[model samples]
Target: MPTLKLAIADDHELFRKGFISMLSNVPDFEFVLEAANGQELLDKMPGHQPDIVLMDLQMPVMDGMQATEVLFEQYPTIKVIVVSMYDEDRFIIHMLEKGVHGYLLKDTTPDEVEKAIRRVADEGFYYSDFVSRVMHRKMVNRLPANKHPFFPNATNVGLSNREQEVLQLLCDGLSTSEISDKLFISSRTVEGHRLRILEKTGTKNTAAAVAYAYKNHLI
Candidate 1:
């Protein structure tokens, strides 16, 4: 298998070294570059062009949010996973809005980190169990009436209840395969539901559909 190229950006030297060491044993991950801060990350990224970036939220010369915005603007294909000490809802929401593929706490184990990287690289979103729970609860509490819970302006015109459930699972960041396993259905069935959901909502992608749902208080 081809290795996944990764770049790590953090202000602290010790933590950067520790992270590099921890990832050294993961077979498919290759550390392609390291940066002391977000500015350095931005400066080095054009040349290195790693597939994934492990970013710290707080760093000198430029913070992770700024760097992430810049990176996404310039390199939309590169995936970013924020590994930070902060777990505030504001920070989480902000990073998500800024297009971070994953948000992880700093205390995550090395194995968890490896898993998260792999998941985000494959599925486009990665959340720990705790983060998942938090997001779910938040979604439940914020669910809006008169809108399909997964699509705000979506009329729910021709969708069945099962399709709505699948959309919710998608908005909750479950991959189609995961949704199939969770619902005890086939992956192809889940994929069909996804296509229908996209059509009904008039959204091109999952992220935009989710954002529309959230913005209009649909979920």
Candidate 2:
């Protein structure tokens, strides 16, 4: 059982200290760094090499969203888990799209915090039941058929109905496994659909595929 190095970035000193205090009692958790804002976290991250970061979305300098993006761009292997007071679906969806490993509300229990960290570290993502339901609903409520006019060549790209479902889920920021569960398909099958969707849409990655879907009203 190797210790997991942890970093926390939050503007509130009291909340940050509370997390540190809680982590201090856990045998397998190591508190490596704390920063008041995103820029400071980025600045301190290079040499510390934490395994996971507990990020706050609202901070004085740069904020968590920008920091998460920059951190992953620079160090893609680092796992980021957002811990904030916000439980809004939109915010959760946005963080998911930006490739965060997990989302936790500030009021989350200590046990949940531990679970979220371990799950994200081991399984790649940790979305609570609420977050999962929101994601599922977002995908289910998409327009029945393509309603908006698409790009000149995009409509001709011809994505199938199943592939369109996968694309909408991707746009909603569901992980491959989450999408699989939602659609009652295997993750591999979901991935295959994703690849085909990209190919048919002539896009490169999930983000691009999502953009193409929105622009073409394929969702």
Candidate 3:
């Protein structure tokens, strides 16, 4: 097997060093870049291009989300498998939707990590086809309750008609106060609906929520 070039972008020195040390025993992985943050990773990508990146979610200068967005937009060829401590469905779905190949927790065994890396490198995915099917089928339309897999919990709490109206106006570039005025509701209520939307869609902010709405054909 061809040795796969690898890179890891994490803030903790111990984790990075330890992970590299662990992988040293495995000849399939060759560490080419060890970045302290997302910016460093991107800055070094021009020279040290790895076949796959093990990205961390939380870092100081330029977070993993921002870097992942840039990677998905710019370095479309490089596979990214998020290796973080967060195993929540929200975080997993968040990274997966942003074009990452996989999401693994920080404490996962080295063998599992290597398996995930190899799967991503060879098959262009770490999970089974079920996940891909779920993503494509559910994200393309507003599914009814109990109609999906990755977001089983989220789909159970489908958006209300009022919430859909709020989302449409938000997509139309209306501010919270403006939406409140147009809908004859308080700004607080509109803000509350926005938060709920974000929570349900596993989005970080209004922009992400709007993107999710467009992806799901909600707006």
Best by TM-score: 1
Mind giving the per-residue lDDT tens digits that candidate 2 earns over 1-219?
A: 999999999999999999999977989999889999999998998789899999999999699999988998898878898999998878877777676877889998999899888877764567676666666565556554444233433346777778878877776667788888999999999989988976887754454455445545566
Q: For candidate 1, lDDT tens digit of each residue in 20-125?
A: 9889788888998999888999888767899999999999889998998888888888989999999887677667666677888989988899888888777666
Worst 10 residues of 1 by lDDT: 148-157
Against the true structure, whose lDDT is highest? 2
Q: What 10-residue stretch in candidate 3 is worst by lDDT?
A: 127-136
Q: Candidate 2 — which residues are off by over 4 angstroms?
A: 145-219
Model 3 scores a TM of 0.61
TM-score for predicted model 1 compared with the true structure = 0.80
TM-score of each: 0.80, 0.70, 0.61
The deviation in Å at residue 77 for candidate 3 is 0.4
Ranking of models by TM-score: 1, 2, 3
